[model samples]
Target: MPLRLPPLPALRFFEAAGRHQSFKLAAAELNVTPSAISHGIVGLEQALGVELFVREPRGISLTASGADYLSYVSEAFSLIAIGTQRLPNHRADRPIALSCAPTFASRWLLPRLAGFRARWPNVNVSVDTSHRQVGFPVDGFDFAIRLSRAPVAGTAWTRLFGERFVPVCSPAYLETLRDGHGNADLRRATLIHVNAASEDWQAWLDATGIEGFDTTGGLRVDTIQLAFEAAGMGLGVALGRRPLVDPDLDRGALVEADPATIASTTAYWLVSAENGDRRPELADFKRWLVSEAEHLETHADASGQTVRAAVS
Candidate 1:
């Protein structure tokens, strides 16, 4: 007896189209044109005697059947990837590729990666700083660290830690905020704003119930790192997210302008495919990352300080 199956290429097209819900995107991922993807999917539908996608005026969507098929197809691909990595000839020292936002990569992960390297001398880690949504295996990344209010769908994820934002500035700038009566006055202080996090300053003000300060005037920078740098140079007060601002606070480069802190809805998440941990090196990396996050949380709990938010 022989197994009945559609052509492998057709299956690939169908899976990609269904996953992205866009023939254009599927074509891009497969390095083919939209017409080619459409033809391949039509061919697949004819072979299976069933339609996988529901064509719409604006775009395409997976039929209920298509969604069900995608689950199986995706799982099959994940298993193949795991099995291939487990083969005897597979390189055990293959580098672990990760995707994350630039601010996180620079302010937090990069500073701490040396510790991971010291622990696992054999495993090399590659980091790609991207704010775009990335797919696993398709993007050729072993894992991704995403900041989101909720877990990303269609992937396995672990919440690393939540974030809290506080206003930070140089010691001199902090002193400048004080009046002759030694009372804190923010009306005269410059507000340094990160363009990406434009609402942070206002959010902090609202959360702290601090009135009469105009958040409209500020020096706007594109990234949190740049904002922190500007604040360090005495440009203005930047709303600094904890863990990201821990190093600056520790080194005396930045200080909390106010003790009030506002919690962020978003948290850092470690994301990967279902079988991402099957590889020995990847499994070790996951364990180490989780352990590091736990250690940081534990240390923060015991410190009783708002500025020193995490592990030293």
Candidate 2:
């Protein structure tokens, strides 16, 4: 059933008058004559069968009934404005839809996303994880994080960071390894494969000239972080990607089982479609990402180790 209510236009004038306590002030705000404001309020009060305002020689003020009604009317108008805000013409801000790999999102990006929010609180960011590369101009993604050596054609590729390969193991597991040849002793250690198409463990092993290790036997996980955690728990030696393992290594959660490391061609790239940076928020995000990447690279360069990421 329709709500039993006074006329909306009259109610608007009444609320404005009630708030200002002066028909002249309400008329000035509403761009109407003072008489119109007074007439609208009078009609509203009549429709509600209540004297909503008390007029005086000096001015006018809302009665107790009007004050009570003003609260509900003002809230209703606020709700109406809120409901209208979702309309395309009314909304000034839209969420920056970002697509990225699950591992990269969780391990690297999510941890650092707080800084972005703190800086650009008004700009909304929505992240979705997908192993598959998003189709630009069709998928509707504003930005994407692609971990690959080659950039997707026709897209702007902003290099986030380069990746390297290392075999990471828990301190407890490293303690069990033979001292003379850590790489060769890894033959006895269990391998935690990330199950990525790149086969990081094998790539690292081949780079170090280590052979005859039983690569076939080990627990396999779908993502790098899961394998990292498994390795940290002393389950097995998992292949660690750059930056992702840096945190664990620094915290002593995991250690590089082999001193040798290989700088892979693969790296994390920020991919955007043509004209994707048209939005100011997107441009800021791109700049922020580049800044973060530069800082990471600089720190890694200072330490003589390089920045690195997602296995694509």
Candidate 3:
């Protein structure tokens, strides 16, 4: 049997009114007047031969038929939206959607992405930098790299690498410390704080079991990357992530404060929807990611030796 579909504009009007229970609000969203919205709904109800909504004194309510149809309408709209979003990717030569933390994207992922692109020249990568947790199926992301101690529930997760924390400062700042007689003299130096995670400084202090130094005295920034930059500019000493700061350390832009360090409770992870098992793109991206991660681990191990030697 052929499906008899209502006019799309009328269906859209009906759906919006049903959702908000207000013709005026629906009109605002649809960029039409309230009368236009109401007229459209009435026309739709007439076509369907059913009263879809009850006109209440204060507002409006859905009729039984309206409630039943509303469910189908909402689902239809959702599917339409999803389809619309996927259209561009479908036509593109290489389509991959990746989401990750902003700082991690800037510091770690961006540097290594060129390699991925070189290996898979046909793959088009779209990167989204957001702190919000992205859910699969609903979020429409193909894959994500996340920093956390535990995998997000209900997702396929792979540990990319562990992270460690170290105190870092610019060469100029280190010179100041050396001139002032060393890190133990940092009591008089400026400290940079990352406001997002208050425990970072405390964790380093606890790991080193260092006492008598005030960890809280300094300029506070929202992101680790910003703090790292501030430290590079000799603004203050920043608590740094080992992997993210490796380049700076190698360039002699920053120096480690101590040989002792603590493993971050949070580690970098590669994640995809459990249902993404069947997606060829997701599979290829995952395999590529694992290999890249292994390569990074090897590089970091070698870099750590140089950092230790330079500091010693």
Candidate 4:
């Protein structure tokens, strides 16, 4: 059966009014007068045989039916926008869409992006750094770096690198403690914690069997990057991942407190649609990602050995 569709102008008018609950605001957005917006919305309501909005003297409010319909309409428009933007001819000069966790993108990928750009100067790369999982077919992302223990189902997955977790502090913070390389040493310093992973500090304590430590002291942050920053400012000792803190460790902004690091159950996974085999750009990206992961793995192994040696 053919789908009956409302006029684009009417739908646009209704969507704008539903969003802002003000015809004046809708008119401003549409670059028309309030009466024009009202006319369009009224026409839309008549065509649908329902009162979409209740007009109050001060403003407007959605009826129950209008609220429900507005949700679907808003979603439909969002999907339409995504579809139009992702269309081959409609897209900007950049052709690749890469989704990543914000922390990973900021701490690791951003630093190394110049290398990828140097190699693929013509291929445009678009990065999405939302924490939400990207739905391959629905979200239309070509590739993603997901921080997870397992690969996403229904997609081709490549393991990136296992993350190592350890206690880290700024040089000045550590100098104050003076003691090095034990669970006991950490107890004397202020401890920074990431609130998102509530169990991380407990897990570290359980693994190391450290005593007399107050896990709840100092600053509590919502993100690993923020925790690291706080620790770097001599706020406290932060439990950090090697990938996110490696550059800091190299630059002397932070130093690992213990050689005994915990291997995170979760690791970064490189994911793409199984059907991504058809696109040349997708294929190139997957190959590049695997090579990059291999490089990271090698460096991680060497770093682990160095830490072990230093601790011994």
Candidate 5:
């Protein structure tokens, strides 16, 4: 008898949902809705004639069957990625194509790219920025930097840095709020928001639990780099993550608006294809990248003594 198989699309959804342990997160990875993931998984369960998840009131958990099946599916995907990466065209001299989040590409990596180029003059690299997670090996990108509190989809998930948030603005902008303490006069100032990310003024505000100011009243930009740029130009106060703002702080172009910092559980992960370890340039890149992140201050509060200012 011929072997039975679930629909390929359903299998893919099941794998993603199982790996993340959340339909919502799985939907994010697959760029679909949670309902779609649920439907797909339901379809798969019907096809397999088994319960794959133990659905609870709050969230879903994988059944023993689902966990066992996921291990196999994940391994198969890894094997495919490894095989593709080992092809003849993936030569040592081929320029390492790195994909990254747009903000990270502009603010973090590109600024430090000169160091990498100088260290490996003979090697070449091309950087592509995307908000979506691309398929490893199939996307033709050798590596990618993912910003998340959890592991990103792919094989090698080496952590590069943990994230922390602080509000930053030009020195001139800070002067405007000199008499203002806390959210008092600061509420009237323009706010800069990175629309693509969740690390917004609202998130920072939530973490700090400082009330009264409107978190939504700000200039919204598509990327975090633009947020910093606007803040540096005194356009508004931007919630700056440590990984991207440390350079600005060091140069005196920007300063902390508040001394309090919101430490992010998510960090940057260096994700790559399954065969990334076997690649020639990966070792060099990882070593240099790790060293740079190690030097970034995760706990330093640069903004002067934090104080409560009245919402004047």
Candidate 6:
């Protein structure tokens, strides 16, 4: 007997709309018009004799029936992905294309990637150190690591870690700034700033309630990695974001100039296609990445006097 079901295209439209909770976003992802998505979903609802969404002024949300149906539809798609992956012509050796910021690619990911390789020797990752946002599948990227305050729209997001920006400098440089109280006196010290993250210094200072520290003038560099390099050379104090700076701190190449830290409003997140982790390789990578992040958080400095700052 032939399968009795809704039209495949209508199912596809319904799945995308349900996943995103917005007809507009669904249209964007599917490369169609919002009207087309709405019409398709409406047709599907009519065929099933059910209302799939609770349309509101601000947005649309899945109804109870819609939510239940979505699970089955999502599972069907996952099976399709897995089946396609297992096909004879499928290239198992193909690299998993990834996009991320250059600084993160160098200072953080590169250092830890060797372990990922060891665990999944056949699974290769091609890292694209591009700062620009990329469209998934269309851009040929399987995953992306991004720093943002919230999850990127139209993709599945797994938060890697929250960020804490701390003041760091060479031990020798720090020694030169100590006052009679044996505390690092930043008011007399040169402030190093990353041109892209000029607000870090001010955020740290505000969070610490430190007065008389001038952020108006200092060594300005293009990247956080460069700023750290300058600080390591005993140039001046730089605000180093956590996890990225964790390795340096462990190596004693840099020390916290002050005990206070600003918990940034932003964090690092791993993004992929919706339901992308259904692939066994992607699932493994996601698990490994989360575990690595958890390990870092477990061993991170607990002694720092933390102050929340909405650092961009």
Instruction: Give candidate 2 misplaced runs (Cα > 4 Å).
Output: 1-91, 179-184, 306-312
Instruction: For residues 188-305, write the lDDT of model 1, one tens digit per residue.
Output: 8899888777347777776667789887787988988898899999998998888899999999999988887767767789999877777787888899888888887788668675
TM-score of 4: 0.68
Candidate 2 per-residue C-alpha lDDT over 76-172 given as tens digits, one digit per residue, 9 for 90 to 100: 7755644454356543576888998877887788888999999998888889984544545334567898878788777789888877778889999
TM-score of each: 0.74, 0.66, 0.68, 0.68, 0.66, 0.68
Candidate 1: list runs displaced more than 4 Å: 1-80, 306-312
Report the Cα lDDT for residue 140, model 5: 63
lDDT for predicted candidate 2 compared with the true structure: 0.78
lDDT of 3 by residue, 164-185 (tens): 7888888777767764335435
Better of 1 and 3 by lDDT: 1
As a whole number from 0 to 100, the lDDT of residue 35 in candidate 1 is 99
lDDT of 6 by residue, 190-291 (tens): 888887763578777767677887688999898888999999999999898887887889899999988777788778899987776655787888899889
Question: What C-alpha lDDT, on a 0 to 100 scale, does residue 114 get in candidate 4?
Answer: 84
Q: Could you tell me which residue pairs clash in candidate 6?
A: none
lDDT score, candidate 4 = 0.77
Clashes of 4: 0
In the range 174-208, model 4's lDDT, one tens digit per residue, is 77776555233676788888887634666666666
Please give the lDDT score for candidate 6: 0.82
Model 3 scores a C-alpha lDDT of 0.77
Once model 5 is optimally superposed onto the true structure by TM-score, how far is the C-alpha of residue 30 displaced, in angstroms? 18
How accurate locally is residue 246 in candidate 4, as Cα lDDT from 0 to 100?
88
Candidate 6 regions with alpha-carbon error over 4 angstroms: 1-88, 301-312
lDDT of 1: 0.83
When summed lDDT is taken over every stretch of 10 residues in candidate 2, the lowest stretch is: 303-312
Global fold similarity of model 5 (TM-score): 0.66
Judging by TM-score against the true structure, name the best candidate: 1
